[model samples]
Target chain A: MGEFELIRNFFAAAPCAQGGEGVALGIGDDCALLAIPTGEQLAISTDTLVAGVHFADPCDPFLLGQRSLAVAVSDLAAMGATPIAFTLALTLPTVTTDWLQAYARGLSLMAQSCRVALVGGDTTRGPLSMTMTVFGRVPNGLALTRSGAQPGDLLCVGGELGNGAGALPLVLGERTAEPAIADPLLAHYWSPQPQLALGQALRGKATAALDISDGLLADCGHIALASKVAVQVECDRLPLSSALVAFLGKAGAQNAALSGGDDYVLAFTLPSVELPPLLAEGWPIHVVGRIVAGQGVTLLDSDGQDITPQTRGYQHFRESP
Target chain B: MGEFELIRNFFAAAPCAQGGEGVALGIGDDCALLAIPTGEQLAISTDTLVAGVHFADPCDPFLLGQRSLAVAVSDLAAMGATPIAFTLALTLPTVTTDWLQAYARGLSLMAQSCRVALVGGDTTRGPLSMTMTVFGRVPNGLALTRSGAQPGDLLCVGGELGNGAGALPLVLGERTAEPAIADPLLAHYWSPQPQLALGQALRGKATAALDISDGLLADCGHIALASKVAVQVECDRLPLSSALVAFLGKAGAQNAALSGGDDYVLAFTLPSVELPPLLAEGWPIHVVGRIVAGQGVTLLDSDGQDITPQTRGYQHFRESP
Candidate 1:
């Protein structure tokens, strides 16, 4: 079959493409038609992941596919929008049915899990890469943004941190770990789930929010600049996974959790009073810091010593290749 | 500045990125928030252009930028949707300030011309490729899809074709032309205007439609398969521009129009009875063929003799790398 037919038969034939909520017309069209309901808004994001840059070139096709969609969907999760549809622009060096099938399986698996539909896409001939543009919906004026943090608000994270970064040693073939440590760390690196539920639960409750992609410190700095408030992150209070601690050790794990990249956890700010109900209801909200009146971010020791961050997270252009 | 800062300052600083219609929030966020009108449905499409495969690597970045956005927006035009916003995913091997400034200028020019805004995007270091996902809005049940044709419907085109295909020889340095012929062909190649207005006029009138990116005959095959109707194209009636004929001669231009790709024109089917009024309004609609009873497409000469196609348009996988 031709490339277009490959896209039609494989990617477009998935369950989500058969017509789901908001998708008026799915594949086999110039553009996918989506009906946005009244009193709602569409949240859109685009992310490109390149082989050998974003991940290893010869990595498992299934894992690559899963990681690709997961990273892009995390943006929507940060916006507190319900998943709707996504378009995949895939470029491959060669047409290998095995690779395509595995990739499609991984993409389909993630689509089903996230409740996202494959609306439309184009397949091309080039180096290995994928660019995913996802669309979701949120009620008007209710989407969470990184520009609403206020002084005296509590800063919390939805899940454990440093797992993705802790997997780097194993991912690059520099280290080995026991299954107890390896399983969770590798899972976090390959398939970090977007906390869509937590984002929705925070809707108007959290004053500011964003997914932790570029590490906790860098992304929280985004909140600080946009919300124009200072943030104090307690080094002792970070919620590191047990697997990560076991894999990287205490001080190393602490550094990775605060400064390492690719953690898709949610870091948000809300009133100190609002945390109890969510915590009481068994949400995974771990309070790590608080918003202050000034600007910039300050890292503190357990003893309240001023041990501000000396290192920054990954910035694509600034780093040497 | 970092990659994110580069995007925010260079691309996000474009006029279109600043609070245009339907865009509630634009760049500098996890996701761009857009509000489709009460009765409108969202139309989405994505297209990727890679250096060396889609275009020459050393080609003008400015023209590449213009062509990239134009190609994706053409799909929106074909869907009869008004352009709203677009997200650009750019993967580059190196950082060149001058190249980015020129490219952004070209992108901003087309975004302004097409009335589309820059919403959100991600920039990364990798092979040179750009993926643009565009969004637009159309009234419910009014999108012009490629699935509604019937027998006896008059097949027409919105504007002249073959110019883009006819430009390939010159684009690849295989041939050269005088200014009068070369300029139009080059423009058609680098920056063909999307027929947004023509598509809007055809909304409820035309039965089925799509932009002719994959040349006429192959795109006609798309309508045939989707709508389950036969299409017949008369070679003598194709609307070719003087510039194409001057560059490639009559026979060569006709072959290019029939078999070559990258012509961003609209092809549609409407009843012969509905043509007069649209024509009288001077909308540039040219009748070229008719829908027939059987399936697939048949190419005919002025003598009304059948000469079905032996060539297909550009399919990435089918092409020899």
Candidate 2:
């Protein structure tokens, strides 16, 4: 075999690439085989992170590896699907064994945390980037979708929000703080846990669901658009992590919670009655707002007055509108 | 919504993104849901192509779109799986409406040709590259694999090879030829038709199968290593298209067939008893060699003398042995 094929061997030897439940066959094949249970639908999502575009070029490869898989797996959580397997197509300007080993370790850790196996992937030389396609399975008619929310449903988030956004300054090396403040924020930035169990818990209870990648207001707008109902965000109720609040202060943290992206937290609309049972079951269900009769999404002040901002979240492109 | 999300809308409106058979949900969701049939396994593969490495940077985006998806689907074909759907993770240096339209059109055409839906994808700004992940379904215990070859099996290729390699000079603007030769070679390079039907036909018959992306010899070595049997390729029996021979001469075309990469043709090991019926049914089964009780791959002259070349095929990295 050529030297390049050895890189593939390195990945093949990774713990996560070994066959796991639902994986009929893993790496070393032209195609990996996944066995889906009868009556289950496969959930698939693809996410790409480009060096310099998605993260700093010199950022930690280990963190990059963890973040990449975590973000992709979050989509499965949004869909309320059980994590199955994932394939990564990685491109790099050059091969560095040190970088690869560290990256693979991070990937393996995330795969274990998310309960997903590394099934197959392609490795190539180019500008550094990676695309992860995650697969999951959910029973037919049970996978969560954004189009099912009703007018009276309460909107909720899985847990704390804004930490990823609050951590950006630190990640770009523009700011530094006490370890107590920076640690949690940086951890959220580099290793956002996909709320898979919470998503599955919300499957039958949630009227509509999605993971918060594009800030809270913008992602809520997606649900409003898809469900044909207005969403009201209670700005006062927005969840902010302690580290985020310490770093950005109340107003900045609140703004980050409202308009920041990359949170990777589940946001969903649920019937008010469904909340108590799930909350009692210990799911991290945090009420953030409600669905109303109007169209589009609106942010409301404590007095319930309209206080929406023009720029709701981060946008990578500026296409003609 | 931000202008950048419109790029997603552009793809969402493409013909291939519409829900099709086995697609429970298509675009505009956190995850696309695919319904896997009972008693069938899902086959998946990912392939990435980077500008300047896999193809010319300034080459036609339309052709790039087609070639990118086609090559990825070839892996499903190698697994004897029925086409279902695919996701695209596209990274671009910048957004160009004209480029996006042409590229989407090309991708749509290829998707239709392969009968696979564009279920979902991610579009981001970065150095130009794309990763395609294709999903297909095959019956349990029936999918073809690369580790099933046994001694006394006939080594075969689905059709003519080396056209992709022979067209490289023309693609790079270093050579010119008549339309009869150049047209076919360029077509092979830009739009290889995955032999899905042939692969399905070989199910339970061909002991081992894989698409030839790493040339005949190198890929044969993969089969030999996996199946623990040596593959003998009779150089005199190598199949070459008239166009390839016309462009590169017989010896050059033979060399390309042996050592050049990106052919995207299926090579398989089938018991000698199974070939006649398939050939009778009009499958382009070409007997190139045979499997023997040994290790590695061997290239033999007309007189049956060993003549293996040193460098087998393309490799992106050179790691220490």
- Among residues 3 or more apart in sequence or in different chains, the pairs in candidate 1 whose N, CA or C atoms overlap within 3 Å are none
- In terms of docking quality, model 2 is medium
DockQ of each: 0.88, 0.73
Cα lDDT of model 2 by residue, B1-321, tens digit: 343465466688888887679998998889999999889999999999988888987999889889999999999989999999999888887777888888999999999999999988888878889999999999999999999999999999999989999999999999999999999999999999999999899999999999999889999999999999999999999999999998899999999998888899999999999989998999999999999999999999999999888876767664431
Question: Where's the lowest-lDDT run of ten residues in candidate 2 chain A?
Answer: A1-10
> What would the DockQ be for model 1?
0.88
| lDDT value, candidate 1, whole model | 0.90
> lDDT tens digits, residues B264-291, model 1?
9999999888899999989999888999
Best model per DockQ: 1
Model 2 stretches astray by more than 4 angstroms: A1-4, A319-321, B1-4, B318-321
* lDDT of all predictions: 0.90, 0.91
